[model samples]
Target: MKKKINPSREWYVLYVKSRHERKIEALLKENNIETFLPLVKTVREWSDRKKIIESPLFPSYLFVKIDFRKESEKVLAIRGFCFFVRFGTEFAKIQEHEINSIKLLMEIDASMEVENNHIQPQVGELRKIEIGALGGLGCEIIKVNNENKIIVRIDSINQNILATIPSSYLTQLATV
Candidate 1:
């Protein structure tokens, strides 16, 4: 018999315990639940030398593709699983384009850096990258650090991740 795919299933983002993303992912997979955990390769320092490590792109966050009408409880029961990301009282179902954009961001070369600055800037226009790797995704230009570095904000999981894009790669989008 072939496994049935439920059309009602939707992708939802779940908040997990800090640094336990991989563990929760493993547990969910072991239980046969579909999960997507985006990771980024970063270099870490130690007394001996530098070592490259794979870190969660959005720390403490993971996505699950499941039929929310039935499988949400199963997801909540998993260890380290917290509440679903919500915008008011209802669960926020992630769109396919958002997931695709994240995959695109992850596949791009080491040019992208995770933005850690919590300060939200009040300036800059929303623009789409039209040139290279980040092409076609909508982003907000936060600041122009110099001629070569322009700080840009990319949205993920109802939050923004900042990356410094080379000036030539950005094209200003006219806001109407």
Candidate 2:
């Protein structure tokens, strides 16, 4: 039997308690609510040893695909849920493509690597990251090391994470 789809159900962004994103996601799923908490696997360095852990890509935020009219209160009742992000009087809706994009980014293995020396360019060329963890972000390629490793500054996220992506994944922006 085919399950009926609810046309009103859309992806909505929610702010949850700090450090409680995963817990809330588990709770919502137990209650039969569809939730998406995008996470990234990274190496965490400690004084003694290094540990690889999965952390939320966007801290304190998760998306729920639900019929807001019927399930808003149920979502709010979850202990860690803070509130829905609002755009004017209405709750902000996340485009389906954006959610899919984030999922695709997390799936990419970019070998998150960084070079110590900061490369500065006289004039930087703007380009888009077509693949890897920082996909969809616009970066300025400041330096290309032997044509294999290029230094780029991702301007969208306030703090940039260093990752090594193949140059073939980059697309040069045409001059406007």
Candidate 3:
């Protein structure tokens, strides 16, 4: 049996056209719809010079907070607005805590890279940070370039955030 979702405002992911994330975000906000487009600054280099640019962390995707039954059609009608991300027939809903996690990540300004969720076989066990900035955040240890890295998977968006962390801050979680 399918589980019933709460009929209140919840976070949903929307897939938009390539490189149009910011524009769509503006349009959605103009319509009074709450949206979150997480962006990160990166330095881009060219033959002439280097310039810093802000780009969406999750390219081609953004999160919208809405009551799906009432506001979905309004969202869908906007220009460059695409359909909501889905798992089977149901919309993929993001938990409030997950959104807060992303917000915290942005606030910390950690050096990290986003990877597509085509994760390889686990090399190490699941662990959580015991101290420091990301304390209490659960992550899996993965071996990359002969070094261990902490990978946090955001399942709703099919992305993994890999950050360089010292082993001393890690505490193994008890397996059920």
Best by TM-score: 3
Off by over 4 Å in 3: 1-7, 112-123, 130-136, 144-148
Q: Sort all candidates by lDDT, best to worst.
A: 3, 1, 2
Which 10-residue span in candidate 1 carries the lowest summed lDDT? 147-156
Every model's TM-score: 0.77, 0.69, 0.81
Residue by residue across 1-176, what tens digits does model 1's lDDT show? 98788888888988888999999999999988888898999999999999999999889888999988798888888867777988788787777666766787788873654343433333476666776555677777666444223333433356665666665555567668
Which candidate order results from sorting by TM-score in descending order?
Answer: 3, 1, 2
TM-score of 2: 0.69
lDDT of each residue in 1-176, candidate 2, tens digit only: 98688888998888889999999999999988999988888799999999999999778878899999899888988986799977678787776666765676678765544433433222265666776655666666655563333344422222244445556666766677
What is each predicted model's overall lDDT from 0 to 1? 0.73, 0.71, 0.79
Candidate 2 — which residues are off by over 4 angstroms? 1-4, 112-164, 172-176
Q: On residues 61-147, what C-alpha lDDT tens digit does candidate 3 reach at each position? A: 899999988999999989998779989988888877778877876787665443433333246778876655566778888874434
